[model samples]
Structures are given as structure tokens and as C-alpha cells.
Target: MIEIKGLHKYYGNHHVLKDINLDIGEPGIYAILGPNGSGKSTLLKSIIGLVNPRQGTISVNGISVAGTHAYRNEISYLPQIARFPDNLRVFELIRLIKEIRNEEADESELVNLFQVESDIRKRLRNLSGGTRQKVNMILGFLFDTPYLILDEPTISLDPVSLTKFRKIISEKKEQGKIIIYTTHIMNLVEELSDHIILLLEGRIIFKGGLKDIYGKTGSSSLENAISMLVDKNGK
Candidate 1:
């Protein structure tokens, strides 16, 4: 379980996260939806111990994230933008990551699943944007950790790749993995997310299921419901 309480962060004089309190004790896809600069990435980073909060506490499986990297072993993070050495081949990057983690991962099946098998020998600079995103996705799931944190992973995926991505997500769900992602695509949110964490201006205005959102806003569609909630609380 990931528990967060009274979480606060600041960037100089600007407040980023404001008294954030949340608990993620279940296994499912949780979508963190918000406008630009709404502290979504900051919150995710805090959970992974990349960003420390000025106040409050974060605990994963009864272990405090403060001053500890031990909790990171159970987490797999895929940032919104992954920068790699331009000269490195796809397979070389994969091998490097596996070595860093010191864990045996059979990326062969995943490489084929993402249909990037042929591109493994090519350098990162040679791969297209979409293909690079596929490689990022492949690395994210290769660990099979209990927790997966992704930041806008589907930015450049084609329809076919998106379909395959959804398939893998469902498979992960079946394995009871806790998947948390941030995306602006409402269609993906409507289809994949089991829970929603809506933040606006560094505050969580809503956190519940899609059905709960529909009922709250009295709107039939997820997009409309979210718009209503944002409009209502944004002021």
C-alpha cells in the first residue's frame, strides 16, 4: 500500500503540491488527470523518492520512503521523456538497464510483443519517435514489479501499438499490479482506468471511479464530467 498524507512541496516561492493526502491500497490502473503544471509529475516523483516533500509522509508497504532507496526495488518508473545515449543500440540500453537493476529479465518476449525485435540492433538515434516510445514502454514493463508509474507513455504510439499496449495493461491487471499513469487522453482514461485522481492547481478536486464521476457531474460522458468538475473547482 502507498499512503501519502499532508504532502507539500515548493519550488522556491511557488507552491507545487499543497497538503496532498492520498492512499493507494488497491491493485488497478489509477489515472492522474490534471492540466499542465498541476503537480501530477511532482506527486509521482515524490512516491518514487525522486522528489522530496517539504511536509508529510509517504510509505510503501509499511516502509517510509524518506531517506531510503530500498522501496524503489518494487517500483518501475517510465518518465514522460526518457533520454538515452544517442549512440547506444536498443539492445545495449536494455542490457545496461538489466545490469543496473542486477535482475534477470527476459526482454526477448517483450521486444517481440512490442514488435521492436528488428530495431534492437539499431541505435537510439535511428529509431522513429513512435518506435522509441515503444521501446520505453517495453522497458517499463520488463521488470514486472508490483508498482508501475508511467508519465504520458502513449504520446506517439500508432493505433496498432496502442492496441497492443492495452492488451499488456489488461494482462498486468490480471496479475494484480498497481499501475499509475498520467495522460490527457480521455478515451484511454475512459477505457483503461479503474480509478481517477483529478488534480487542479495543485489540489485534488476529485478521486473516485468513472461511474462516480458521471454521477457527480450529472453528465453522461467522462470528458464532460471531468470538464464540469474542473470548471467547478478550478476557480
Candidate 2:
């Protein structure tokens, strides 16, 4: 559903992304794992057109992402750190997000999805960090876009809420949505990803399904398997 070809990004003398090529298929969660400074965030930003690559091309559903807002409507992204107006109520913030996306969201649906009915009137600043993360998660899922890019989405989320969020994502996957997730948590990657893309020194060293990783590492556990890959290929 998404293709990135020969992508390259640089910061002065330092190269961040190097000749990266990726094909992300639909209906499955793709996990991107890399050490810090390996350009995982840079790759995500490039896909969203927030960071322009010095080389290569990105296309989504047969449309080029060079200079168009049309492609933006097809995807939703959740950054690692999300900040909202401290004074805005939960419902008000959600309403604002829906309006910004030019979407007519179902309030009750969101309330049930995030279980925010009782908390809707509370200010964002008064909410716990986990609840704030929930708000961000709901906003990312609100529009039901075809492609979702989530970075450290489980951070600050309570175990119950994380489980609920996982269920929601699983439902989305069953519906054939494309998901790209980035995180340091190996366990979540094992549970959620069908394909794993490992980035090392600004380039992809491994790209294949989880089963392929298992076979390559000769490990039964996904975490142990990925640890092997990371240890071998990551810097």
C-alpha cells in the first residue's frame, strides 16, 4: 500500500537515512526496530512528508507524495510525544481533531472506544499521563484512515488500556488497514507485527515476516529472535 524507494536524508555532514527501500503491505502491522540515531523517526517523518528526503520517491496507493495534501487524508500518525492544550476538555479536543480532519466523528463511538464518557468534561492537564496517551491513541484511530503510523503508542498507557488498544488495532488489521509501528518494546513488536523492518545506521538490514526472522535466528521466542537480529545487525 506504501512504497519507499532509495530514500536518503542527511543532516549537514551526517547522513540519517541511506538508500532505504521499503514496501509496506496492507492489512498487517509492520514493526520498525532500530537503535537510537538509526533514522527510524526520520523514515517515519519522510513517509508523512514532514521531512523531505534528498533522494528517492514515496508513493501511496499509486499517488505520489511530492507536494500534495490528498495523500495526507489517507493516513494518520501518532508521534512519540503528543502535546495538547492543557485547558481543553477531552470531548472538546476530540471535536477539534475531528474538525481538523474534516471528519464528522461519532461522539458516542469515540466515548465507547476510549471509555471516555465520564472523563469527557475533564481538562487535559488534569488527566493522568496514561489517560493523555489514551486521548492521543483515540485521536490517531478516530478518522479510520487506511494507513496508521504509531511511534511508541503504548507508552504511558496502563496495562488494561494497552490491551484494549491492542484489540482495537487487531480489529483494524482484520479490516485490511495498513499499520506501521515503531518502538523499542520487543514484546509488543512480536505480538503485533506480521513483518519486521530492522534499521541499522540509517539503512534497512532486515525486512521480512516474523516467521522468516524466527527461521533465520533459530529461536522459538520472537523477543529472543529479534534480539539476535539486533545484536548482529544493529550498531
Q: If scored against the real structure, what TM-score would every candidate get?
A: 0.98, 0.92
Per-residue CA lDDT of candidate 2, range 1-235, in tens? 8999998999887899999988776579999988877888889889899888888999999788988778988898998877788999998998898888897766577568667777889999998888888888888887878999988888887788888878988998998999898888888878888889988889788889888988899998877876687788754
Residue pairs clashing in model 1 are: none
lDDT at position 199, candidate 1? 92
| Model 1 poorest ten-residue lDDT run | 165-174
lDDT of 1 by residue, 1-235 (tens): 9999999999887899998999998999999999999999999999999888899999999999999998888999998889999999999999999999888899998898889988999999999999999999988988979999999989999999989989988888899999999999999999999999999989999999999999999998888988899898977
Supply candidate 2's per-residue lDDT for 137: 84
Q: Rate the local accuracy (lDDT) of all candidates.
A: 0.92, 0.85
Best by TM-score: 1
Kindly provide the TM-score of model 1 when superposed on the true structure, using C-alpha atoms: 0.98
Q: Which stretches of candidate 2 lie over 4 Å from their true place?
A: none
Q: How accurate locally is residue 222 in candidate 2, as Cα lDDT from 0 to 100?
A: 73
Q: Which 10-residue window of candidate 2 scores lowest in summed lDDT?
A: 105-114
